[model samples]
Target: MSIKGSLRSRSLTSTPSSILKRPKTLVHRLSEIRNKPTEVKFELTKQLKCIFDGYVQKTESKEYEKLVIMIRDAKLTDADISSILKEINECISILDQKFRLFVEAILSIEWTSRGSEVIEEYQVFIVNLLSAHTYHAKMVIDKLVKLFFPGPDDSDWEDGVPADEDCAKCINVHALFNSLLSEVPMCQAIFVSSLYSHFPYYNKSTHIHEYYLHNLLWILEYRPNLRPEILNLIFSKLIIMDVNAPREEIEKYLNADEEMFLMDEETKSIKSSTTAFTQVNRHALAHTLDVCLDKIFNYFVSECHDSQTKEIIWEKAKNLYLEMLPIFDRLILPTYDIHHVQFIMFMMTCFKTTITEGFLNYLWKKVCNLNVAPVLRQAAVNYIASLVARSNFVPLAMIKGTLQQLAEWIHSYISSQDGFEYVNSDIRSHSVFYAVCQALFYIVAFRYKDFVQSKKNIVFLQSLNMAKMVTSRLNPLRVCQHAVVQNFAAVTRKYQLAYCYSVIEHNSRNTLPVIYLDEKGTTVTSDNTLNTFFPFDPFILERSAKKIEPFYKEYQEADESAETVMEETSEVDDFLLNEFPNSSKNKTQKFSYGSSPGFKFK
Candidate 1:
């Protein structure tokens, strides 16, 4: 008879002595388990542990997966599974070793392809592993990997450990990981999926950040069989799980790894040796960025509930944006899709804290489009204008038009609760309408070139600059561009005021149009000096070119006026006749601006 059948028969029996008691049953079982001597108990425990492990392995095995599929098809919900485990607790201790054998047997099967609930057998062990805050999940994984997939000291699975010492070394991590990677795609997919999904739902208990250089190097460089799409997926996960991880972690994983080209460290493994910079492949990087933007925008617009989460997302995303600055800074006119315009905007919003150099130029060439939604296009334009203002660069006509577009978009998205300026102080901060004063300075100064000939555009630029200049809310009537006090006696020239204001901002918050150049000869800047944030007015830069004259004469006309005058005087009457009709031989006159803004004079 089945256990249930037996329980029913006992319940129907008339004898009161047959009535069962609940409390002592567990106590009696405990006594029975402990009654044996030390040696016998140890041996028994060991044997049963092996059996339990086997059971887990069996559940994981492909050959017996028919059993697993049958269980899955049964679709016992999580509640049913929990009840089943709870009821079997008494039976487990007595058959501990036997159960382990079953567990390991199940574990041996590949679970990667199976979806979420495939966590069945391993969940108990995983809970044990995490009990005391398993330092980091990675450490546990490393230990577990070593236990079943045993490997020795100094044996790197990635680069073949030096063959000379190899036979003595431990099993290669690559061997197990390679097998697991192939055997359990869905397992990996779930691991990554859960990890990536957990960012916003953060509890110190859940944010088990254990991944280090070893795993990252494999995911990034090797694993060719992995769908390359997984990379895009991984990047999206990082963006979504967005947390303000230490900047050092970013360096630790990607930059500190000597094997990765993104790092500056010297080569370690000769087989994978490449420059640190070369480690980040542009195509791969672009693909990752493309997906990250998509995920972030989607989450922000759809799922993100509060500004706090959005800020956290932005903080995490900002680091990624900074990492990509090298690529974006290098390319001016990269061929891009129209969809990318929105993505660029997302990046600007997230990383607006650090508006990269050449970024505006990049957007102008790639994302600016009138063919799209006017408001969307305007957002692009306004963003460029804001960058122009925030940066010390001279904002040209195209850039000014962009700022106008942003202004229009601001009006359009005003009703939007897309986690920006809908409630709190965001508008007071990152929004384009309330951008920094410097962005306007560049716009006004640079726009003169394009608008000097057009009265209407010039008026528009002046109006925008004037609006930007009214920097205070309380005193909107006043234009206080000069009132924001500046410190650091670096560059004293008005021309360099903007550079001085920006170069050292995070530490010293001075956002004025000023540069405090070092006292002239004491600290002169070199031609090669790198000031990524400082903008050079092209007209101002052109002055450094040396003037060259055509050499059509037998001897070049005397460069020195003294020699020329001497030659003319020596020629006596020939020069006296009104310079012989003003030197048919040659002519020269000094040029000057003489109070004109154009600085052009004859």
Candidate 2:
């Protein structure tokens, strides 16, 4: 027989039951019924509605699982997937609240694991759903947000799939969001809301928060207009974690040299037994704060470097500083006892001198504004003193000018108190005054060499009338931090700028009254001594310190004979240990008076 006749005979002999049949996939079935008559389409829609209704009713049905499996396992072409999605988009009327499970099943598919073509098709389908039914937008956005981080049980691989595939998944998710944002501008609000709402709890695992923070920062690149909101949200969440993790605990754990203690089993046992539980949580939190701030600081650095030209980078850094000011005011300024979050501003200042000046002016304004809360004002001055003292970029002229301003304010405050017959010398009532004095003394102590560098500078420093301020009845020398007072006394006496050691001696012999009246008409006795609370003392976070340390100024030891310096430091330590006892042991820095424990010598 001829070849054609042989093929025809074989085709005729092949029976329906004898041939292997290909199972109909969900995509194929949908495409077939989509172009059929209206009656057939109605029946298909009715069946889907019934299946989803059963799902909602908690009825035992395999249809939902079967559909999910088909979506998950079927190796459909891009055209086929698009066809299926197009048909679903047409049936949005029937796919209402009742069909949520069906929509979720579509969303749950690991389309990111598929090819680029499949991801694009899946994105298109999502855009269509969001455009046609705005109500499901939250559900869609929520699912995408959840994919930002890995699950607790997830490993590097599971069932032959690399868990590192989350990188690809995150890329696809952000791409889908970009499309949604463009196609449906209104979705931006929902997207931002979703981001804020889905932020991992503060106590969540470190990696989880890191992942989410990274994605949020990625969003900032495309959504430049949303920079303020996104960054504000970040700072808000960061501060929450920051305030909860005590500064002392963070310093202890972060500065700990784990390798050094390896052979000391006794030390390990003591630490583990006394502080294992509390320390673990605190350490984890501090670590998270460190890492998150590192990421943000790195991002800031990258933004500045994006431009090759120094001028452009400087301009960008300036703009970024301006943008972050409101965020700092709204989120960081008023909040008290936050250890490290404010370094975001510090990092920005490192980019340019003008940026540093701008930040100082911002803080100084807050310090001088009477409308601002007293606590906030005190916090502002603390920041100014710390920044000026610790930033290497701040010019000496600016330091002198800042000192002059602080002196002027102190003198004005003392003059204002002259009108009252009975002066309330209480530190709490006069906290801002004492705070300003502390700031002046701190700046003078830290930068005394700058003032004495030339005759003109020395003359300018002496003209500030530090003598009258120290001798006033308010007694700032008595109220300021003892370490700061001692340091100031040593530096000023050496420079002959002002003599305060006598005042210091007097303060050492007597204790200030600690009783204060509360709003409830109750007399409360509390230790209201102003702490040496320098907010920008040191950036000790392991990861981001590289960016910060180069610009950071460490506390320099006074230029004096070794014996003299040691004698002074020893005297201060004895005084603090005698008076504060508990805090003095933990809070005081070695060799450096006025420096907190966070301070470290180069």
Candidate 3:
């Protein structure tokens, strides 16, 4: 008879003892499991499998909770937890429905009493299990990424109509998975691989595509090793996602007008529709491209060290640069001005190792290309200037010629403001002037001292001198006489003031006497040599030096007297201090006083 059948039979028995007696039930058997350690382990495994089977069939059972209580009540050891994990791993390929339940049960082992080491011991297994079951892991991760990076879609937003219980369950699952991933660093590789593979399928209308890119970027923050491949993928997408919108269609939507315009017979509906989709993709791709560029540049600066890695990164970047060169302006024109600067900065920053004379000349061509937007041209100038200031990649000899070219360009912009008619207004010219000035400041701040020490490099020093002279003649407010360009003037003025302030800061803080360019082209460090344009007051520094000199001399005399008294009182001779290893007063004080800033005695 079955257990239930036996129970029914026992209740109907005539004898009082038989009436009271009952056959062992499942629950009774479960209670008996607690009586012995070996029996408990066997019962635990059987109960887990039964719970899993019931879950697979969609049958109701309170056994999951009962198992939790059993594990808690039995105080399972690490050996038991490992056994449970092994069983779960074995059952994973058996039933798809049981996968999540098995994962939950394995993770539920009372890590507190079994000791935290139990989790560490099984973390690798958990990571492998998740990786082997890639589809389920990706589904959970995708849901979480969508929640975190909800794009233009309004439906997934939290402020939308209330989410049902399933959404909450997904969120809780994501948290658990995230916590698990954080603890197991090795699992990140699997997660990143899975996320990266989803890129080709990201063209859907839903914000799933946007979420996909955002997650890739999110992963990059923690895993910088993936920079090169991620950058290559992003750059490849750049060419693929180019927007070829008709010039007329783009202009029509620039200013949003509520009034409906009559459709022109000349307009092609097919082209307009294509343009709209292309525009959206281009905008999205631009953001992704920027993130890729930013991450790649940051990695090169901070974490990139292996020479082999550097060569690989350089080749990938060089290929992208060549590929993107043709479509650069077509895609970027008429976008946000900051994006223009970012594009230029990325181009400049990503090539640290492969910068050549050809590349420098190419950037020079861009800066001097009057046909280009004044803003972009100025950005090019800033990039070159930063290269000149911070990097030794550019040949020092070539920098001289580059500076000469830039000085002439700035003079041309200032003289023929009307030729800047290609731009919107004189504001463009003023901005160009301001950028040149800032560039000059960096050049002077960088190379001026080098010139001072190594005066024999006359070619570079002369080029720098010419740049300084050009800037000195160009008045800050000369480009914008009209009130319309006052904001631009203010901006130019800010850069000028910044340059002046930086010069003064260096002058004041420098310990050596400041150097000045005299009209006779003589560099001097003398206080009596006056240049009204010079920012620092030499007389004040001299006076301060004089005031402190006597006091310092008195202190020196007192120190000398003390030294003499010590010499007379001590039995040890000065020769002992020089010759012996452990002599008293082996060390002596050296005092300095009366030195001016930017001065050093030969």
Candidate 4:
């Protein structure tokens, strides 16, 4: 038989009528009622009310599936969707407070899980819902923000994994948000408010923080106008989490051997410690901060490096630095005792030399501005020292220039106090002076190899008058950290630049009073010691360290003769025994070091 004859001869009676007939969909019924008389439309409205009420009461009804099909069908044209939305809005009274279950069902649909065409339809529906129904804007926006994180069951899965379905959901959620923001400009404020209100709590799990932060940064790709507000909000929350975490405990846990103990169990035991349960709580917070910061650092790396040309990368990095500077000042600068949070600024500086210079100059101005708060000025100088010492991107000229300016400032301060012979060497009265002095010692100790690389460098170091600063009546060596002072002495003696051993020896023989006085000369603290905080100390975060380590400079041990090593080893043993009296012999020796002097946490 011919091909046409063969098809006609097939059994046509076997086809089912349900398969042949077009089903009556919600959108088709709603469109048909748009032009009908009031009575006819009211009848349809009454039917919609019944369907909504029945769906809420018995979720198994086929009416709920019809409603979802109406919202998510790709074959429906925009005009058809608009007509359906108009009828839904007209009958929204039926979906009142009691029918919230139906509303939630609509909002809970996995729009991202559908095909692309269906996703587009769902986006259109949500944008229109937000714009037309102001009362539902909060509900809709809250749902959108909640979608920024993974569902509770999927929380253990790694976020942003390319193979994971949840990753696509994240991308689509932000895409939907961008569409909503663009289509309904009036909802922008509401959307931002929802973001702030929905941010993961400080005590939330680490994965929760990572997922939310990753999604928040994804929003920045399209919403450049809200960059400042969004970044400020993120960093502000980060500072809160950062301050609550104790850096010392975090380091101890990170450096501990995993084979010796389980981290989760240790954290729980720490929480149960009656003497320091608060510290244990902070331990968990610290892990969350670490994960959150890693996400932010990854965002920054992608923003700066995704460009094609170096000039474009530089421009992007410069702009990013400018945006973050105010946040650093407002949130990170004045905050005390935070460990790794400010490294965000350090990572930014690594992008270009010009940016590094700009950051250094800004910090130097703060340090030299006598009118600024003393505490902030001290913190600014600390940041400068840490950045100069730890960043490989900083040039030799910039380092020398910073050292010169610091020396000039210290000399000027000493000259100003010339007439006050009765003024004692009180740390509280001259906190900034002591802070700068320690900064100078730290930088020189860290980068002394660079200074001794050439004769010109040596001359530059000699011109700083290190001996005068060390021997001044202010007695900076007496107040600076012991490890820093010892390191400075060793380097200056090795290079024949300046002698600090005599001053250190004199300081060791006598114990200065522990009393501290405030600006009003009232006693403030009895335990007087300068904080040995290096803000850029080795970035230990496992995930983000990949972005940081290439630009970071680890401490280099100076060359030592056999005799010198033997002598330093004996000294370190004695120091360990004295410092950790209760520690076992092996434990004390574990941290003992010889000749390589840098910041050593106690």
| TM-score per model over all chains | 0.28, 0.78, 0.38, 0.75
* Per-residue alpha-carbon lDDT of candidate 2 for residues 1-602, written as tens digits (9 for 90 to 100): 99999999888887564567767889999999886654211112234455655666778367755655565555555665665566665556656665676688788766777778778878988897888778888999998888887766755232222345666778888888888999999999998999999998877766777788888988987788888888889999999888766766545553463531122334442232124334335556666777788788878888887646544376777777878988888889888767678888887887777878877888889889999988888989999998888788898888877988999999999999999898977877888889999998888877776767689998888899898989998989887876677667666665677777667767777875587679999998866578547888765555556667777776655332421222445554344322211221333332123235232221
Candidate number with greatest TM-score: 2
Residue 547 lDDT, candidate 1, scale 0-100: 13
Error of 4 at 396 (Å): 1.0
Candidate 4, residues 1-602: lDDT per residue as tens digits? 99887677564543566578988999889988885644211112234656776776895467755655555433444454445555566666455455555566567656677667667767776776666656677888898899887677774545434337767888788888888888888889998999899998776777777778877887888998888889999998998887776555555664564421233744444432223433336566766776778788878878888545534376778788899999999999988767668888988888788989999999999988879999999999999998999888899999999999999999998998888867667777788999999999999988988878799999999999999999899889888887787677767766767877667667777775676566799976543457647677666555556667788787665432401221454543233222211222222221222122234433
Q: Native-vs-model 3 lDDT?
A: 0.43
- The TM-score of predicted model 1 comes to 0.28
Residue 386 error, candidate 2, Å: 0.6
lDDT (Cα, 0-100) at 279 in candidate 1: 39
Lowest lDDT sum, 10 consecutive residues, model 2, at 576-585
Report the error of model 4 at residue 477, Å.
1.2
What are the clash counts of all predictions, listed in order?
A: 66, 0, 7, 0
Deviation (Å) of 247 in candidate 1: 12
C-alpha RMSD of candidate 3: 24.5
Per-candidate Cα lDDT values, in order, are: 0.33, 0.73, 0.43, 0.73
Q: Write down the lDDT that model 2 would get.
A: 0.73
lDDT of 3 by residue, 1-602 (tens): 89999988877775687657886889879888766465344246464577767755777356665665565445577777777666666655653534554454454554422344555555545555655665456544453334434324334323122245334433443444455576655556555565455564323432344434444544555545665556545544433432322223322332233222222335333222334334233223333333334343443343323465544455545554554444344443223222112233233333553544555566678766778787666656655654554443455666666666766776565566545445432233256665665455445444443343464654444543333433343443222211112222222222232122222223234334445666899985643211111111011111122321222211111122212121444333221222111223333222222111111111
